[model samples]
Target chain A: AQSVTQPDIHITVSEGASLELRCNYSYGATPYLFWYVQSPGQGLQLLLKYFSGDTLVQGIKGFEAEFKRSQSSFNLRKPSVHWSDAAEYFCAVGARLEGSQGNLIFGKGTKLSVKP
Target chain B: SQTIHQWPATLVQPVGSPLSLECTVEGTSNPNLYWYRQAAGRGLQLLFYSVGIGQISSEVPQNLSASRPQDRQFILSSKKLLLSDSGFYLCAWSSRVHEQYFGPGTRLTVT
Candidate 1:
């Protein structure tokens, strides 16, 4: 079965410190990978997506994720953490077939906490 | 640019009452729509999806049902609400590329 795993349930990082969140996926095919961030009580916002071509994809809010096919991982990283970046992050994977319905499998999510 | 809208940004309902949440997309046509629920400290779970009018696919077997009466509209309904249904409900839309755009979400509290 296809699934996404975000090993870290929560992570704490001081403001201005570099951050990295790990994600691993089990998929049968070349999958479409995505990262989304959700603020408390708010909807999810797309952080970045990896469809094809480049292994490293840049997203909004100064976040970037790299797709490592061999490791079956797409880890999100940022050079410096901001206090506002304290949110839950999710990793998702979906089929890459053309015209396929957007049925994505998401990980349990990792909550990031930024310390002052 | 495509935009997704989900409303009654917040809902507080008694258990055993009926429930209805609406979602609509603008600037796109015949897009794939999805309903997902995010419980406390958990990731989003896919509930339902629609590829077109009157075409609905359920991913989970639960008390919820979904309808797509129109191309751009999707509704999630339950004949009776359950306390387990209290969570953040999100509506999303996606095109051929399959990257979904989510709405502001509805926070449902079952009391």
Candidate 2:
């Protein structure tokens, strides 16, 4: 079974500090990866995705992710954190499966707390 | 432009009450529709998905059911919701490319 794991349950950082949220996936093949953000009472928003080609993929809201096949990891990063960036982050992996188009397995989210 | 919509942004219902949540999409055809549930501060759990009308697949056995009677419309229903059913419900649509686009969620609270 393909699965996604986010080791950190919660993380706190200052508004001007750098940010990095870790994601590790267990998949047999080269998997499609994505980063999504969810705020309180809101839907999950796509941050970035990696299908093929470039290892580093940039997305909306000044977010970027790097796909490391050797590490089986795709980590989300930001040069400087903003207060608005405080939200729950989820890393997901998509793979083809029988009886379904494709399933997106998500990691246990990491809640980001940003301070002034 | 393509857009997905989920209704009843927030709802509070008794434990034995019925449930009906709706989702619709615009500007696409033969799109894949999905239902997902998120517990408080938790990741998304795939509930059900439909590749086309009348074709539903369940990821987990739960107190929920889904229906896609139209190409771009999906519904989630329950005979009686439990307190455990309180969470955020999201609907998503996608093309064959497999990149899903989500709608503003519905916060369901079953008392």
- Among the numbered candidates, top DockQ falls to 1
Across A1-116, the per-residue lDDT of candidate 2 in tens digits comes to: 88899999999999989999999999989788889998888888889889899999999999999999999999999999999999999999888554448668899999999999
Clashing pairs in 2: none
Candidate 1, after superposition: displacement of residue A84 in Å? 1.1
B1-111 in candidate 1: lDDT tens per residue? 888889989999999999999999999988999999988877788999988899999999999999999999999999999999999999999887888899999999999
Clashes of 1: 0
DockQ of prediction 1: 0.80
**Cα distance off (Å), candidate 2, residue B40:** 1.7
lDDT of 2 at A94: 87
Native-interface RMSD of candidate 1 = 0.9
Candidate 1 docks at the CAPRI level of high
Give the C-alpha lDDT of model 2.
0.91
- In the predicted model 1, the residue pairs found to clash are none
Model 2 ranges off by over 4 Å: A96-100
Per-residue alpha-carbon lDDT of candidate 1 for residues A1-116, written as tens digits (9 for 90 to 100): 88899999999999999999999999888799999998888888899999899999999999999999999999999999999999999999989777678788899999999999
Separate DockQ for every predicted complex: 0.80, 0.68
